[model samples]
Target: MASELIPNAFLASPRSVRSSLVSRLLAAALLTIGAIAPALAGELLPLADKAVVLAFGDSLTSGIGGSGENYPQRLATLIGHEVINAGVPGETTAQGRERLSTVLRDSRPGLLILCLGVNDFLRGVPEAQIAANLGAMLDLAADASVPVLLLAVPAPGASQIDPLFARLARLGQVRIDLHAMADTLMQPALKAGLVHPNAEGYRQIAKAVAQSLRDGGALISR
Candidate 1:
Protein backbone atom coordinates (compact mmCIF):
# COMPACT_ATOMS: atom_id res chain seq x y z
CA MET A 1 0.00 0.00 0.00
CA ALA A 2 2.85 2.39 0.81
CA SER A 3 4.61 1.70 -2.53
CA GLU A 4 1.38 2.28 -4.51
CA LEU A 5 0.76 5.55 -2.66
CA ILE A 6 4.27 6.81 -3.56
CA PRO A 7 3.67 6.32 -7.31
CA ASN A 8 0.30 8.01 -7.13
CA ALA A 9 1.80 10.99 -5.35
CA PHE A 10 4.56 11.35 -7.93
CA LEU A 11 2.30 11.11 -10.98
CA ALA A 12 0.00 13.92 -12.10
CA SER A 13 -2.63 13.91 -14.83
CA PRO A 14 -1.23 15.70 -17.90
CA ARG A 15 -4.44 17.56 -18.55
CA SER A 16 -4.60 18.87 -15.00
CA VAL A 17 -0.97 19.90 -15.11
CA ARG A 18 -1.47 21.77 -18.37
CA SER A 19 -4.55 23.47 -17.02
CA SER A 20 -2.64 24.60 -13.93
CA LEU A 21 0.21 25.94 -16.03
CA VAL A 22 -2.15 27.92 -18.21
CA SER A 23 -3.86 29.35 -15.19
CA ARG A 24 -0.57 30.47 -13.71
CA LEU A 25 0.54 32.06 -16.95
CA LEU A 26 -2.71 33.97 -17.24
CA ALA A 27 -2.52 35.18 -13.66
CA ALA A 28 1.04 36.37 -14.12
CA ALA A 29 0.21 38.22 -17.33
CA LEU A 30 -2.76 39.95 -15.71
CA LEU A 31 -0.67 41.03 -12.76
CA THR A 32 2.06 42.41 -14.95
CA ILE A 33 -0.37 44.30 -17.19
CA GLY A 34 -2.21 45.72 -14.19
CA ALA A 35 1.08 46.91 -12.72
CA ILE A 36 2.19 48.71 -15.88
CA ALA A 37 -1.15 50.00 -17.19
CA PRO A 38 -0.92 53.29 -15.38
CA ALA A 39 2.33 54.23 -17.07
CA LEU A 40 0.68 53.71 -20.46
CA ALA A 41 -2.12 56.12 -19.60
CA GLY A 42 -0.11 59.05 -20.78
CA GLU A 43 -1.03 61.01 -23.90
CA LEU A 44 -0.78 59.12 -27.18
CA LEU A 45 2.37 59.51 -29.25
CA PRO A 46 1.44 60.59 -32.74
CA LEU A 47 3.78 59.64 -35.55
CA ALA A 48 4.26 61.40 -38.81
CA ASP A 49 5.32 59.68 -42.04
CA LYS A 50 8.81 61.04 -41.59
CA ALA A 51 9.10 59.97 -37.96
CA VAL A 52 11.84 57.43 -37.26
CA VAL A 53 11.93 54.64 -34.69
CA LEU A 54 15.28 53.29 -33.54
CA ALA A 55 15.33 49.60 -32.59
CA PHE A 56 18.39 48.85 -30.47
CA GLY A 57 19.26 45.42 -29.19
CA ASP A 58 21.41 42.34 -29.71
CA SER A 59 21.07 39.62 -32.39
CA LEU A 60 17.42 39.14 -31.58
CA THR A 61 16.68 42.58 -32.96
CA SER A 62 19.30 42.11 -35.71
CA GLY A 63 17.28 39.37 -37.45
CA ILE A 64 19.55 36.40 -36.77
CA GLY A 65 17.14 33.57 -37.61
CA GLY A 66 14.57 35.43 -39.62
CA SER A 67 14.52 35.37 -43.43
CA GLY A 68 16.32 38.65 -43.94
CA GLU A 69 13.48 40.55 -42.21
CA ASN A 70 13.34 41.22 -38.51
CA TYR A 71 10.86 42.67 -36.03
CA PRO A 72 11.78 46.24 -36.87
CA GLN A 73 11.08 45.67 -40.56
CA ARG A 74 7.71 44.10 -39.85
CA LEU A 75 6.99 46.83 -37.31
CA ALA A 76 7.68 49.47 -39.93
CA THR A 77 5.03 48.01 -42.21
CA LEU A 78 2.50 47.60 -39.41
CA ILE A 79 2.87 51.18 -38.14
CA GLY A 80 3.77 52.93 -41.40
CA HIS A 81 6.92 54.50 -40.05
CA GLU A 82 10.66 54.14 -40.47
CA VAL A 83 12.26 51.73 -37.99
CA ILE A 84 16.03 51.68 -38.00
CA ASN A 85 17.50 48.41 -36.80
CA ALA A 86 20.59 49.05 -34.71
CA GLY A 87 21.19 45.58 -33.37
CA VAL A 88 24.66 44.04 -33.04
CA PRO A 89 25.11 40.34 -32.40
CA GLY A 90 26.63 39.24 -29.06
CA GLU A 91 26.48 42.79 -27.71
CA THR A 92 26.39 43.32 -23.98
CA THR A 93 24.65 46.24 -22.26
CA ALA A 94 27.99 47.91 -21.57
CA GLN A 95 28.87 47.85 -25.26
CA GLY A 96 25.42 49.11 -26.15
CA ARG A 97 25.85 52.01 -23.72
CA GLU A 98 29.09 53.00 -25.35
CA ARG A 99 27.63 53.05 -28.89
CA LEU A 100 24.21 54.50 -28.05
CA SER A 101 25.31 58.11 -28.01
CA THR A 102 26.57 57.92 -31.57
CA VAL A 103 23.43 56.11 -32.77
CA LEU A 104 21.19 58.64 -31.04
CA ARG A 105 23.03 61.54 -32.59
CA ASP A 106 22.98 59.99 -36.05
CA SER A 107 19.42 58.73 -36.06
CA ARG A 108 17.83 61.53 -34.09
CA PRO A 109 14.81 59.28 -34.01
CA GLY A 110 11.42 60.31 -32.70
CA LEU A 111 11.04 57.04 -30.82
CA LEU A 112 13.32 54.32 -29.46
CA ILE A 113 12.63 50.60 -29.06
CA LEU A 114 15.09 49.17 -26.53
CA CYS A 115 15.46 45.39 -26.06
CA LEU A 116 18.67 44.16 -24.45
CA GLY A 117 20.43 42.40 -21.54
CA VAL A 118 19.90 38.75 -22.44
CA ASN A 119 23.63 38.25 -22.98
CA ASP A 120 24.38 39.93 -19.70
CA PHE A 121 21.95 37.65 -17.95
CA LEU A 122 23.36 34.56 -19.66
CA ARG A 123 26.92 35.53 -18.75
CA GLY A 124 26.03 35.90 -15.07
CA VAL A 125 26.37 39.67 -14.99
CA PRO A 126 24.85 41.21 -11.89
CA GLU A 127 21.20 42.21 -12.23
CA ALA A 128 21.81 45.58 -10.59
CA GLN A 129 24.44 46.42 -13.19
CA ILE A 130 22.07 45.41 -15.98
CA ALA A 131 19.37 47.64 -14.52
CA ALA A 132 21.76 50.53 -14.14
CA ASN A 133 22.93 50.23 -17.75
CA LEU A 134 19.35 50.17 -18.99
CA GLY A 135 18.52 53.12 -16.74
CA ALA A 136 21.35 55.07 -18.32
CA MET A 137 19.96 54.28 -21.77
CA LEU A 138 16.59 55.57 -20.63
CA ASP A 139 18.24 58.74 -19.36
CA LEU A 140 19.72 59.27 -22.81
CA ALA A 141 16.32 58.91 -24.42
CA ALA A 142 14.79 61.28 -21.90
CA ASP A 143 17.45 63.86 -22.60
CA ALA A 144 16.73 63.61 -26.32
CA SER A 145 12.97 63.82 -25.69
CA VAL A 146 12.51 60.49 -27.47
CA PRO A 147 9.48 58.38 -26.65
CA VAL A 148 10.59 54.86 -25.73
CA LEU A 149 8.97 51.44 -25.85
CA LEU A 150 11.02 49.07 -23.71
CA LEU A 151 10.72 45.34 -24.39
CA ALA A 152 11.44 43.18 -21.37
CA VAL A 153 13.35 39.96 -22.11
CA PRO A 154 13.15 37.32 -19.44
CA ALA A 155 16.07 35.28 -18.19
CA PRO A 156 15.83 31.50 -18.41
CA GLY A 157 13.80 29.86 -15.61
CA ALA A 158 12.41 33.25 -14.63
CA SER A 159 8.74 33.94 -14.10
CA GLN A 160 6.69 35.51 -16.86
CA ILE A 161 6.41 38.73 -14.89
CA ASP A 162 9.56 40.66 -13.97
CA PRO A 163 9.50 42.99 -10.98
CA LEU A 164 12.47 44.94 -12.31
CA PHE A 165 10.53 45.81 -15.45
CA ALA A 166 7.47 46.67 -13.35
CA ARG A 167 9.56 49.06 -11.28
CA LEU A 168 10.89 50.79 -14.38
CA ALA A 169 7.39 51.07 -15.85
CA ARG A 170 6.12 52.71 -12.69
CA LEU A 171 8.84 55.29 -13.09
CA GLY A 172 7.08 56.41 -16.33
CA GLN A 173 8.78 54.09 -18.81
CA VAL A 174 6.67 52.23 -21.37
CA ARG A 175 7.23 48.45 -21.55
CA ILE A 176 5.96 45.65 -23.80
CA ASP A 177 5.48 42.17 -22.38
CA LEU A 178 7.63 39.62 -24.24
CA HIS A 179 7.02 36.63 -22.00
CA ALA A 180 4.53 35.09 -24.42
CA MET A 181 6.96 35.40 -27.28
CA ALA A 182 9.67 33.86 -25.16
CA ASP A 183 7.47 30.85 -24.50
CA THR A 184 6.63 30.47 -28.15
CA LEU A 185 10.27 30.61 -29.12
CA MET A 186 10.98 27.62 -26.90
CA GLN A 187 9.15 25.30 -29.26
CA PRO A 188 11.30 23.38 -31.78
CA ALA A 189 9.25 24.58 -34.74
CA LEU A 190 9.64 28.28 -33.88
CA LYS A 191 13.26 28.17 -32.93
CA ALA A 192 16.22 28.34 -35.29
CA GLY A 193 18.66 27.32 -32.58
CA LEU A 194 18.69 27.32 -28.80
CA VAL A 195 18.05 31.05 -28.43
CA HIS A 196 17.03 32.40 -31.79
CA PRO A 197 13.60 32.43 -33.43
CA ASN A 198 12.78 31.30 -36.97
CA ALA A 199 11.13 33.54 -39.56
CA GLU A 200 7.61 32.65 -38.51
CA GLY A 201 8.55 33.22 -34.92
CA TYR A 202 10.00 36.57 -35.82
CA ARG A 203 6.74 37.52 -37.50
CA GLN A 204 4.81 36.62 -34.37
CA ILE A 205 7.18 38.71 -32.27
CA ALA A 206 6.70 41.65 -34.62
CA LYS A 207 2.93 41.34 -34.39
CA ALA A 208 3.10 41.23 -30.61
CA VAL A 209 5.28 44.32 -30.53
CA ALA A 210 3.01 46.20 -32.94
CA GLN A 211 -0.07 45.28 -30.94
CA SER A 212 1.61 46.26 -27.70
CA LEU A 213 2.61 49.61 -29.15
CA ARG A 214 -0.91 50.26 -30.35
CA ASP A 215 -2.42 49.18 -27.03
CA GLY A 216 0.02 51.37 -25.11
CA GLY A 217 -0.92 54.39 -27.28
CA ALA A 218 2.68 54.72 -28.40
CA LEU A 219 1.81 54.38 -32.07
CA ILE A 220 -1.07 56.14 -33.71
CA SER A 221 -2.36 55.41 -37.22
CA ARG A 222 -0.79 57.64 -39.77
Candidate 2:
Protein backbone atom coordinates (compact mmCIF):
# COMPACT_ATOMS: atom_id res chain seq x y z
CA MET A 1 0.00 0.00 0.00
CA ALA A 2 2.86 2.47 0.82
CA SER A 3 4.61 1.69 -2.51
CA GLU A 4 1.36 2.23 -4.45
CA LEU A 5 0.77 5.61 -2.68
CA ILE A 6 4.32 6.75 -3.46
CA PRO A 7 3.86 6.20 -7.23
CA ASN A 8 0.52 8.02 -7.17
CA ALA A 9 2.14 11.06 -5.52
CA PHE A 10 4.95 11.01 -8.07
CA LEU A 11 2.47 10.88 -10.92
CA ALA A 12 0.47 13.77 -9.52
CA SER A 13 3.51 16.00 -8.96
CA PRO A 14 4.29 16.42 -12.67
CA ARG A 15 0.72 17.35 -13.49
CA SER A 16 0.67 19.87 -10.66
CA VAL A 17 3.93 21.40 -11.85
CA ARG A 18 2.64 21.67 -15.41
CA SER A 19 -0.59 23.31 -14.25
CA SER A 20 1.36 25.87 -12.20
CA LEU A 21 3.60 26.67 -15.14
CA VAL A 22 0.59 27.22 -17.37
CA SER A 23 -0.98 29.52 -14.78
CA ARG A 24 2.18 31.59 -14.52
CA LEU A 25 2.35 31.96 -18.30
CA LEU A 26 -1.26 33.07 -18.45
CA ALA A 27 -0.69 35.63 -15.70
CA ALA A 28 2.33 37.04 -17.51
CA ALA A 29 0.34 37.30 -20.74
CA LEU A 30 -2.49 39.11 -18.94
CA LEU A 31 -0.08 41.55 -17.37
CA THR A 32 1.50 42.29 -20.71
CA ILE A 33 -1.89 42.99 -22.22
CA GLY A 34 -2.91 45.21 -19.32
CA ALA A 35 0.25 47.25 -19.65
CA ILE A 36 -0.17 47.80 -23.41
CA ALA A 37 -3.94 48.30 -23.65
CA PRO A 38 -4.11 51.99 -22.75
CA ALA A 39 -1.57 53.10 -25.31
CA LEU A 40 -3.14 50.95 -28.02
CA ALA A 41 -6.63 52.11 -27.15
CA GLY A 42 -5.66 55.78 -27.38
CA GLU A 43 -3.74 55.44 -30.63
CA LEU A 44 -5.19 57.24 -33.65
CA LEU A 45 -4.17 58.21 -37.12
CA PRO A 46 -2.53 61.61 -37.33
CA LEU A 47 -4.91 64.16 -38.77
CA ALA A 48 -3.99 66.53 -41.59
CA ASP A 49 -4.78 70.25 -41.29
CA LYS A 50 -7.74 69.96 -43.64
CA ALA A 51 -8.88 66.51 -42.55
CA VAL A 52 -12.62 66.27 -42.34
CA VAL A 53 -14.26 65.05 -39.13
CA LEU A 54 -17.86 63.99 -39.57
CA ALA A 55 -20.01 64.89 -36.58
CA PHE A 56 -22.97 62.55 -36.91
CA GLY A 57 -25.79 62.60 -34.45
CA ASP A 58 -29.20 64.09 -33.70
CA SER A 59 -30.48 67.45 -32.47
CA LEU A 60 -27.59 68.07 -30.09
CA THR A 61 -25.21 67.88 -33.00
CA SER A 62 -27.49 70.20 -34.96
CA GLY A 63 -27.25 73.08 -32.47
CA ILE A 64 -30.80 72.80 -31.24
CA GLY A 65 -31.09 75.14 -28.31
CA GLY A 66 -27.54 76.31 -28.93
CA SER A 67 -26.75 79.89 -29.91
CA GLY A 68 -26.22 78.92 -33.54
CA GLU A 69 -22.96 77.30 -32.37
CA ASN A 70 -23.24 73.57 -32.37
CA TYR A 71 -20.60 71.22 -30.99
CA PRO A 72 -19.46 70.33 -34.49
CA GLN A 73 -18.86 73.93 -35.40
CA ARG A 74 -17.12 74.55 -32.13
CA LEU A 75 -14.99 71.46 -32.62
CA ALA A 76 -14.05 72.65 -36.09
CA THR A 77 -12.89 75.95 -34.67
CA LEU A 78 -11.03 74.33 -31.81
CA ILE A 79 -9.25 71.73 -33.92
CA GLY A 80 -8.83 73.88 -37.00
CA HIS A 81 -10.30 71.14 -39.16
CA GLU A 82 -13.34 70.80 -41.31
CA VAL A 83 -16.01 69.22 -39.14
CA ILE A 84 -19.05 68.57 -41.25
CA ASN A 85 -22.26 68.61 -39.25
CA ALA A 86 -24.28 65.62 -40.40
CA GLY A 87 -26.73 65.89 -37.59
CA VAL A 88 -30.47 65.71 -38.09
CA PRO A 89 -32.92 66.90 -35.50
CA GLY A 90 -34.98 64.19 -33.78
CA GLU A 91 -33.02 61.37 -35.40
CA THR A 92 -32.67 58.01 -33.68
CA THR A 93 -29.82 55.49 -33.66
CA ALA A 94 -31.55 53.23 -36.17
CA GLN A 95 -32.10 56.14 -38.50
CA GLY A 96 -28.50 57.22 -38.15
CA ARG A 97 -27.29 53.69 -38.89
CA GLU A 98 -29.35 53.65 -42.04
CA ARG A 99 -28.24 57.08 -43.16
CA LEU A 100 -24.57 56.75 -42.20
CA SER A 101 -23.28 55.08 -45.36
CA THR A 102 -24.60 57.81 -47.61
CA VAL A 103 -23.14 60.48 -45.39
CA LEU A 104 -19.79 58.70 -45.38
CA ARG A 105 -19.82 58.51 -49.13
CA ASP A 106 -20.60 62.18 -49.42
CA SER A 107 -18.31 63.51 -46.70
CA ARG A 108 -15.37 61.12 -47.05
CA PRO A 109 -14.24 62.20 -43.65
CA GLY A 110 -11.05 60.98 -41.99
CA LEU A 111 -12.68 60.73 -38.59
CA LEU A 112 -16.20 60.23 -37.29
CA ILE A 113 -17.72 61.71 -34.18
CA LEU A 114 -20.64 59.50 -33.21
CA CYS A 115 -23.04 61.13 -30.76
CA LEU A 116 -26.42 59.63 -31.51
CA GLY A 117 -28.94 57.61 -29.38
CA VAL A 118 -30.42 60.48 -27.38
CA ASN A 119 -33.67 60.36 -29.32
CA ASP A 120 -33.72 56.61 -28.98
CA PHE A 121 -33.26 56.92 -25.26
CA LEU A 122 -36.09 59.45 -25.14
CA ARG A 123 -38.30 57.15 -27.19
CA GLY A 124 -37.69 54.21 -24.83
CA VAL A 125 -35.64 52.17 -27.27
CA PRO A 126 -33.99 49.04 -25.91
CA GLU A 127 -30.32 49.29 -24.99
CA ALA A 128 -29.54 46.28 -27.17
CA GLN A 129 -30.97 47.90 -30.28
CA ILE A 130 -29.10 51.09 -29.56
CA ALA A 131 -25.80 49.23 -29.16
CA ALA A 132 -26.44 47.18 -32.26
CA ASN A 133 -27.18 50.24 -34.35
CA LEU A 134 -24.09 51.98 -33.07
CA GLY A 135 -22.03 48.86 -33.72
CA ALA A 136 -23.22 48.74 -37.30
CA MET A 137 -22.27 52.37 -37.74
CA LEU A 138 -18.82 51.60 -36.34
CA ASP A 139 -18.52 48.69 -38.72
CA LEU A 140 -19.29 51.03 -41.57
CA ALA A 141 -16.57 53.40 -40.46
CA ALA A 142 -14.14 50.51 -40.03
CA ASP A 143 -14.75 49.51 -43.62
CA ALA A 144 -13.82 53.01 -44.67
CA SER A 145 -10.70 53.02 -42.45
CA VAL A 146 -12.14 55.97 -40.58
CA PRO A 147 -11.25 56.36 -36.93
CA VAL A 148 -14.15 57.14 -34.63
CA LEU A 149 -14.63 59.05 -31.39
CA LEU A 150 -17.53 57.68 -29.38
CA LEU A 151 -19.59 60.05 -27.27
CA ALA A 152 -21.74 58.43 -24.66
CA VAL A 153 -25.24 59.79 -24.08
CA PRO A 154 -26.91 58.87 -20.85
CA ALA A 155 -30.57 58.18 -20.37
CA PRO A 156 -32.57 60.69 -18.36
CA GLY A 157 -32.82 60.06 -14.63
CA ALA A 158 -30.34 57.21 -14.75
CA SER A 159 -28.53 56.64 -11.50
CA GLN A 160 -25.35 55.18 -12.97
CA ILE A 161 -23.34 55.52 -16.13
CA ASP A 162 -24.13 53.03 -18.87
CA PRO A 163 -21.42 50.44 -19.54
CA LEU A 164 -22.44 49.62 -23.09
CA PHE A 165 -20.74 52.60 -24.66
CA ALA A 166 -17.49 51.94 -22.88
CA ARG A 167 -17.57 48.34 -23.93
CA LEU A 168 -18.14 49.42 -27.53
CA ALA A 169 -15.33 51.96 -27.29
CA ARG A 170 -12.86 49.24 -26.28
CA LEU A 171 -14.06 46.95 -29.01
CA GLY A 172 -13.99 49.75 -31.56
CA GLN A 173 -10.69 51.23 -30.32
CA VAL A 174 -12.09 54.77 -30.17
CA ARG A 175 -12.09 57.46 -27.53
CA ILE A 176 -14.65 57.15 -24.74
CA ASP A 177 -15.85 59.34 -21.83
CA LEU A 178 -16.77 62.33 -23.99
CA HIS A 179 -20.10 61.98 -22.22
CA ALA A 180 -18.54 63.63 -19.21
CA MET A 181 -18.27 66.83 -21.22
CA ALA A 182 -21.86 66.40 -22.31
CA ASP A 183 -22.86 66.06 -18.69
CA THR A 184 -20.95 69.20 -17.80
CA LEU A 185 -22.69 71.05 -20.58
CA MET A 186 -26.04 69.79 -19.36
CA GLN A 187 -25.94 72.09 -16.34
CA PRO A 188 -28.71 74.66 -16.22
CA ALA A 189 -26.44 77.63 -16.81
CA LEU A 190 -24.85 76.01 -19.83
CA LYS A 191 -27.90 74.34 -21.28
CA ALA A 192 -30.18 76.35 -23.52
CA GLY A 193 -32.84 73.69 -23.14
CA LEU A 194 -33.28 70.45 -21.20
CA VAL A 195 -31.19 68.58 -23.74
CA HIS A 196 -29.03 70.96 -25.70
CA PRO A 197 -26.10 73.10 -24.63
CA ASN A 198 -25.68 76.83 -25.17
CA ALA A 199 -22.82 78.48 -27.03
CA GLU A 200 -20.47 78.54 -24.08
CA GLY A 201 -21.39 74.93 -23.36
CA TYR A 202 -20.63 73.93 -26.93
CA ARG A 203 -17.31 75.69 -26.72
CA GLN A 204 -16.50 73.77 -23.60
CA ILE A 205 -17.44 70.52 -25.26
CA ALA A 206 -15.21 71.37 -28.22
CA LYS A 207 -12.31 72.14 -25.93
CA ALA A 208 -12.73 68.87 -24.10
CA VAL A 209 -12.88 66.93 -27.37
CA ALA A 210 -9.83 68.67 -28.77
CA GLN A 211 -7.88 67.93 -25.62
CA SER A 212 -8.97 64.33 -25.72
CA LEU A 213 -7.85 64.02 -29.32
CA ARG A 214 -4.53 65.56 -28.49
CA ASP A 215 -4.00 63.27 -25.56
CA GLY A 216 -4.89 60.27 -27.69
CA GLY A 217 -2.23 61.31 -30.23
CA ALA A 218 -4.83 61.73 -32.93
CA LEU A 219 -4.32 65.41 -33.66
CA ILE A 220 -1.52 66.38 -36.00
CA SER A 221 0.38 69.62 -35.57
CA ARG A 222 -0.70 72.33 -38.01
Tell me the number of clashing residue pairs for each predicted model. 0, 0
lDDT of 1 by residue, 1-222 (tens): 000000111112333332332233323434433443323334336666698999999988998988796888988898888889999999988889888888999999977888887788779986566666776676666657676777777665454534555455434344445443565455668768776788888887888877766765656664
- Cα lDDT of all candidates, in order? 0.66, 0.68
Kindly state the number of residue pairs that clash in model 1.
0
Residue pairs in candidate 1 whose N, alpha carbon or C atoms collide under 3 angstroms? none
User: Which residue window of length 10 is worst by lDDT in model 2?
Assistant: 1-10
| Lowest lDDT block of 10, candidate 1 | 1-10
Error of 2 at 49 (Å): 2.8
